[model samples]
Target: MSTARDYGLDEDYEWPRPQEGGWIADDLDELPHLPRRTELIDGSLVFASPQTRFHARTVGLLERALVEQAPDTREVYRNFTVTLNERNRPEPDVVVARAGADTGPKLTRLLPGDVVLAAEVVSEDSVDRDRETKPRKYAAAGIRHFWRVEENDGLPVVYVYELDPATKAYGPVGVFHNRLKLTVPFPIDIDLTAVDRRR
Candidate 1:
């Protein structure tokens, strides 16, 4: 059987570039020179800034939990950039890929089909982006599972989503807390307790 290395992504390509470690603004016409995390919102290049300690811990905890709860069969990613086609580039906090995608560049955009799940850990600046805007965008892409980890209020709250074809808007799969493991429509179920333990 062919391994993930057989996918043929040239690892030699220069992937992530240097930026001052924060979000910088630019017009859409001036995008090619940007580092890996830039996104286009309403047609402008907007940088996705560094995560705060709250943001960092939440993401780290969730990453750990996913590793424990998800099957050893697939790959999970954290704080990575994923392109919504060519125009939009919202970097999700976590994405689950099929097992075969493991041998590629860490900074490359995930094609729509390769993704099994997409997650966002909300910091203050991420509120508008995560809960409001991304649902419309993610649902339109036909993604099977989406999650919003809301940490802005200083407590980790999990919002689960399953895209609904009839509404064309993502509807709540559940609103949950650490008391129960947050289950997903995808092939795996993840523990919400790991991230909520920050309290």
Candidate 2:
């Protein structure tokens, strides 16, 4: 039988052929400079399509809103990786995590316990993953809260979810189209329409 090494398949390729099982998170890190963002889902490599200007703007707006409401002990990060497990390392569009004193130049990855909330701005190429696959993984990992942002009729819609410990699944809190008023992570208000106005 031909081994992966014998096929000259090293981890350096951006997107290698899917193996019999699938690729893991470590294989993703071995690739050279990636032209765009990528993720691993159930050991399968998923490369995100180029984001639209509106999409980028929505992420920035959401990040700023979350940061404004987050306490000093919690920090908001944009486009950072979260290691869900050996086979999944999703780079959520925005992540709210517990703040640590170590501000040194060392690298770090957020585990499930460290994450307070994980949010994804739905993209054209990532609809199913964002809506279905990611939520299942995040809930299984015990992340407290999750949010999905989508553009509808040229407007942003925010969907909120809270984990149900009994089921290891997320239960819908509410869906906000024009404005987001919430008190779970913290009391905050955001005008969802601003994402479209900026474009």
Candidate 3:
């Protein structure tokens, strides 16, 4: 039998099994004191170590840039969970949604339809998920835009993608290094180098 430590899970981590009511978003809400970052993927709990300084810097830089460039009608948030489905609630590094999209008394999760853009910053522990699994799921859920930020030789590189409605897949739009200029969801200009410098 596999143990939590064998899977690099913390001792306090509660593994969700299908037989035991399975894991859902509500379960995450119940555990407000979880030490590590956690997400639900296909009813399985995934735990990740805390972000590195560079990772946090990049996420913050992107959030600030997006907020500054986005129109007031759009909302920009960082480290927010978007409920893709019953068993999948991934907290993206940054997300942009239509203003007033979340109407609950208190903000909970953003449904796929409520999201216009979702962005992820690559981390040592999350390369595959950020590059492959997430894009497929996000596209299948009809998220229009997805951006991935990766580090190359200690500098930030942004890959922009847009979902093709007919195919339900993301097509590469642009790869930016120093500056990012796009006019899809809205006109925006971002200085990629600034993200590194801010560190």
Candidate 4:
């Protein structure tokens, strides 16, 4: 059976790392060695195995493309943690945020509202959580944009999701191949086709 501890997850990693000895902050040094998995869902931890070669390629391509294409007003993060709530901190493969005013915390470790875009590259073990559960979770957390990178959907497969305030969740759908470009909430333009285009 898989366990949260097996993946080095705290019952509250999504709440921001708190003061040491504060119950949720125990064993800070051991966090890096824990197994990696989805930490956003309640009741159970989402078990994720290591990334496959194609998965790594997808994440790498997206990270590079976003870093190059995102406006200077935005910062992009790859494979880094971000808070979604009190108990969910699944690190999407990439995160894009508006440039901040030196708020001490780096742009990547954001509160629920700071994120403008989050992307997940599909790995066989995590496709469902990435394409389905995460979109709802990100919407519930008030994120504005989300993308799903399909490693198997032909040569240029990408799915983009947007939150529709009328529905209070991610609803607008975009499907494209080789590349899809989008204008973000205020100060950024994103092109995902360069990243998801694969053989």
Best by lDDT: 3
User: Model 1: runs farther than 4 Å from truth?
Assistant: 1-36, 102-107, 186-199
Q: Model 4, range 1-199, lDDT digits (tens) per residue?
A: 5444445666544423434433221222234444544354542344477677667777787777778777778888877555665556667888887677232243335655778888888777776788788788888888888888785443436787888877868765777666565665433343444444563
Q: Mind giving the per-residue lDDT tens digits that candidate 1 earns over 1-199? A: 3222233324443333434543232222243445445566544455565567777877787677677667765678885555665556566888886766632254455655677788888776668888888778878877778888885356567788887878767888777665335445334454544554654
- Candidate 2 overall lDDT versus native: 0.81
Q: How many backbone clashes are present in model 4?
A: 3
Worst 10 residues of 3 by lDDT: 28-37
Pull out the clashing pairs in model 1: none
In every candidate, how many clashes are there?
0, 0, 0, 3
CA lDDT, every prediction? 0.64, 0.81, 0.83, 0.64
Task: Give candidate 1's whole-model lDDT.
Answer: 0.64
> Which digits, one per residue and each the tens of the lDDT, describe model 2 over residues 151-187?
8887789899999999999999999989999988888
Compare the candidates by TM-score and give the number of the best one.
Answer: 3
Question: What global local distance difference test value does model 3 have?
Answer: 0.83
Model 2 backbone overlap count: 0
Ordering by TM-score: 3, 2, 4, 1
Q: Which pairs clash (backbone N, Cα, C closer than 3 Å) in model 3? A: none
Cα deviation of 73, candidate 4, in Å: 1.3
